[model samples]
Target: MERLQKVIAQAGIASRRKAEELIQQGSVKVNGKVVKELGTKVTRNDRIEVDGIQIEKEEPVYFMLYKPTGVISSVKDEKGRKAVTDFFPMVKERIFPIGRLDYDTSGLLLLTNDGEFANLLMHPRNEIEKVYIAKVKGIIDNEKVRKLQRGVILEDGKTAPAKVKVLGSDRKKETALVEITIHEGRNRQVRRMFEAVGCKVTKLKRERYAFLGLGALRPGDGRALTPHEVKQLRAFASATK
Candidate 1:
């Protein structure tokens, strides 16, 4: 059984914390009874309500693509830039990216038509971990690694703690390759985080999203998500509660 608030949030009613408040306020009804306890448990078949309204379930469709650089994540760009949809002309349905990868970044990206699924994975409050490999200027020192792990101060604000490991360094080119894992989806966050520490990112590529990985898929290639992966993603989302 899952927490009642998690089920409500998974239904796209609100965020997990917001759903908790709704439950406490008698706004959430489970099987027609208003449940106020935060510890209530629920099953997938349970009827959940919010403000006396029922949430309709939508068909879930998930796709993972190895996105190449220079492609916009949107369906169409107003500036005439190429987009991910151009590579999926046969999939005759509307789908959106879970989060995003910058135009100059390449790697794993998840697309789906299910809004709830997207929100559960993409919401910043969920703190779903994302892994990236970045090439930056200079050798990574112990101080830099500690700064990143302890949370670096950026212009926008202090970044959430990141797990950084120096993979290797190029002495001739004066560059370093590091692997960083973070849970926030701020715009260009990985690159900006490096810049905050005085290293300019020359190449950045996402390696993993939650449990999903790029695998052997080449750039501009995609495939349907397996049933096991989808179930694991749902489990991961619910675990955040």
Candidate 2:
């Protein structure tokens, strides 16, 4: 037997937290009986329903999306804005995003129905590294780059040291692209770090996360992760913890 929320999430209804909310709202049923208790136990043979629609367990699905700018990384939005899920119109299993990227920020984003794997990737204890390519508004100097490499104090406190290097320079344009690697998943961290150094971030694109790299995958395209890749990711997560 499994907790109702876990079963619901496994069945791809929603995230575990959101499944609890659905249970409280009296939208969930087990074996044709309405179940409002959050911790109720269920089994594979038991039938589940949400808002009167019966649900069936499906094979776990995973996808790596090269998210493009202007798309929100969420399952649904009240504002009616375009969301990442809209791109996968035929995906029946309810999947949730692994981490997050700002609405205007673009890069590699993983979507999957494996809640435990998602939690492992997002948990702070894992310390999985994420790399980014950022274009800032000003010509950053070597001193500022060194400061960023050593770590800087943000308004919230000191940030984890980041690996930063200037890729090159466009002196006439007054802009430079730099590569940054960080382990902490702070909100808008790369952008914030640049701001702390008095440079405005013009473009931020994630190039890698953990063992996954956004290799020739163009923007807005997605593909299933290989079994080896998934195994490697799980091993990395376990090793980090």
Candidate 3:
């Protein structure tokens, strides 16, 4: 027997963390009865249902994609816009984007069918770092850099401390290139951080996530995650557990 969330994850329904949410929403079942407890366990002979649909176990698959600008991060969008899932028309397993990248932002994006792995990487408690490069309006001075490194107040709340650095500047264009690293994954966080400093971000791209980099992959290109890379991410996830 194994934990309910693990079963759902291994069954290719969703990530373990999302599985827990499904259970709490009363959408999952073990045998005939609804199982809302995250710790509930079941054997292989047990039947599981999610939203009244049976789940089948399958091998996990992981991929890293160079998410191009204008591509949505979700599996499907109601507006009928192309999404990351559209990039892999032939993938057989039910993989999903680990987190998100905005429609306008471009760069590295991870996709996987392993729910536990997805949960681990995206969960804030794990503190996995992501690096981004942004082109912002105006020059970034030492004071602005210090304020960013120290933390800035946002509409939601004060952002956590970040690692900030100026990369380059184009005085004629009134633009500066900056690199910022943080562990949190709040929506358009890097852009908001710059906005807090009176700078408007015009272009933003994720350079690296954890140990993975964009490397030579071009926009819309993708490659399977190596065995070693998967192992490292698994280690990262298990560390917080």
Candidate 4:
């Protein structure tokens, strides 16, 4: 037996937090009885239902979305702004972003209903590497790139040292494309890091995170991750931990 929320999440009913909300709102039932308690437990033999629809245990689903700019990373936006969830309207199973991608910054984002997998990917101890391609104003010198590699202080504090490399330069346009690989998921850390070096970032897109790559996925396109991919991600998390 396990907590009801865990069962709900494992069954792809919703994220653990969302399942808890459903329980609080009297939307979930166990053994044919409405259950509103947060800590209620259920076994495989127990019958679970939501909104009078029977819930069945399902294999966890994982997805990789090539998010476009301007979409919020949340499941729902309170201000009515477009959210990532709007892209997966047909997905019956509930899921949430494993981590986050800021609005106006787009790229690979993972969505999953497995709470334990999400926890592993999001934990700082896992140290999963995320790679990004950034377009910055003006040409950045090698010395400044070295500073990014060494680490720089942000308004909040010092940032972890990142792997920085100059991808190339558009000499006529006075802009440069740089690649940055970081393990820490600080809020807007990539943009802030470039800003700290007096570079204005015009566009930023994540290329990869851990063993997952964006590949040729176009903006706004998404696909469910294969079992092998999911297993690799879990193994990467464990190895990093």
Candidate 5:
């Protein structure tokens, strides 16, 4: 037996967190009976339906996408904008991005039908590092860099310490390439961090997620995660837990 939300998530219907929302919203039924309790568990022999439709378990598929700017990092965009899933036209599984990238920021992103895996990696306790390269409006002085390294205060709260490195700068353009490594997945975190220090991010791209990078793949291209890579990711996440 497994938790109902876990089962729903593994079926590629939604992330475990989203499945809980579905359950609470009275959209989930098991064996023809609405089951709203989050702790409810079900056996393989039981029938699970979400939104009045029975769920089918799909073989989990993992993919790494070289997400491009101007694409939304969602399964589908309500406004008909291009989404990360649009690149996987040949994939039949209901895969979703593990987390997300800003619509205007591009780089390495992971998509998968394994919601449990997604939850594990997105959980803040796991502290998975993500690295970003940002082109800012001005050359960041040592003091501003130190402030970011020490953690800056944002409206939401104080940000975690980030690894900041000034890759280089163009004096004529007054633009500097700053690399930032952070574990927290706050909304527009890199850009916000620079803004908190009086610098504006003109362009940004994520270069790495933990140990994964966008090898030679061009923007909008993707590849499957090798079995070994999946194992390593799971092991690392579990270890951090």
Candidate 6:
């Protein structure tokens, strides 16, 4: 037997956290009975339904996408905007983005049907490192870079110390390219961090996640992860866990 939420997650219905939310919202039923308890467990023979649809386990698949700016990182968009999943027209699994990038931010994004894996990577305690390249409105000096390295206060809270460096600056344009490495996944964090330092992020792109980087992929391109890559990611996640 496995936890109901785990089963739902493994079935590609949602992440384990989202699966728990569904259960608490009374959207999950097992054997025709609504099961709201997070601890509920079930056997393989049991019939599980979510939102009136039966669940079926799917072979887990992992993908790396070069999400372009102006695309939402979601399976669907109610506003008729282009979504990340629209790029995967041939994929059969019900994959979803592990985390989201802003509609205007672009770069490497991961998608998968494995909810447990997603939870492990997305969980704050894991501290999976993400690297971003930002083009900001003003030239960043060594002092501002030091401040970011030491951590800065924001509305949510003080951010953790980050690895920051100024790649280059254009005095004529009054802009700079800064690279920052952080583990937290706060909403629009990179942009907000710059804003806190009196710099506005004019453009942002995630260049790396954990040990993975976007290699030779252009915008709107995607490919399945290699077996070795997946193994390495799982091992890293396990170590962090």
Q: What is the C-alpha lDDT of each candidate?
A: 0.86, 0.86, 0.88, 0.89, 0.92, 0.92
Give the TM-score comparing model 4 with the true structure, all chains together: 0.80
Candidate 6 TM-score, true structure as reference: 0.86
Error of 3 at 153 (Å): 0.4
Mark the 10 consecutive residues where model 4 has the least summed lDDT: 8-17
- In candidate 2, what are the lDDT values of residues 1-241, reduced to their tens digit? 8898887776666768888999999999898889999879987888999999887776678889999999999998999988888778889887778888888789999998877568767878889999999998887999899889988888777888899989988878889999999988888888999999888899899999997998889999988899889889989988999
- Pick by TM-score: 3 or 6, better one: 3
- For model 1, residues 87-194, the per-residue Cα lDDT tens digits are 778876666788889999999999876656778788776788999999999767899899999998877899999999999998788899999999998889999998
**lDDT agreement of model 6 with the native:** 0.92
**Candidate 1 minimal-lDDT segment of 10 residues:** 54-63
What would the TM-scores of all predictions be? 0.77, 0.80, 0.87, 0.80, 0.87, 0.86
What ordering of candidates by TM-score runs from best to worst? 3, 5, 6, 2, 4, 1
**Superior candidate under TM-score, 2 versus 6:** 6
| Model 4 segments more than 4 A misplaced | 1-42, 47-58
Error of 4 at 170 (Å): 3.8
User: Candidate 3 versus the native: TM-score?
Assistant: 0.87
Give the per-residue lDDT of model 6 (tens digit) for 1-241. 8899998987767778899999999999999999999999999889999999999877789999999999999999999999999999999988899899999999999999887888888888889999999999987988899989999999999999999989999989999999999999999998999999999998999999999999999999999999899898888877886
Looking at model 1, how many pairs of residues clash? Answer: 0
Better of 1 and 6 by TM-score: 6
Candidate 1 global lDDT: 0.86
Lowest summed lDDT across 10 adjacent residues in model 3 is found at 9-18
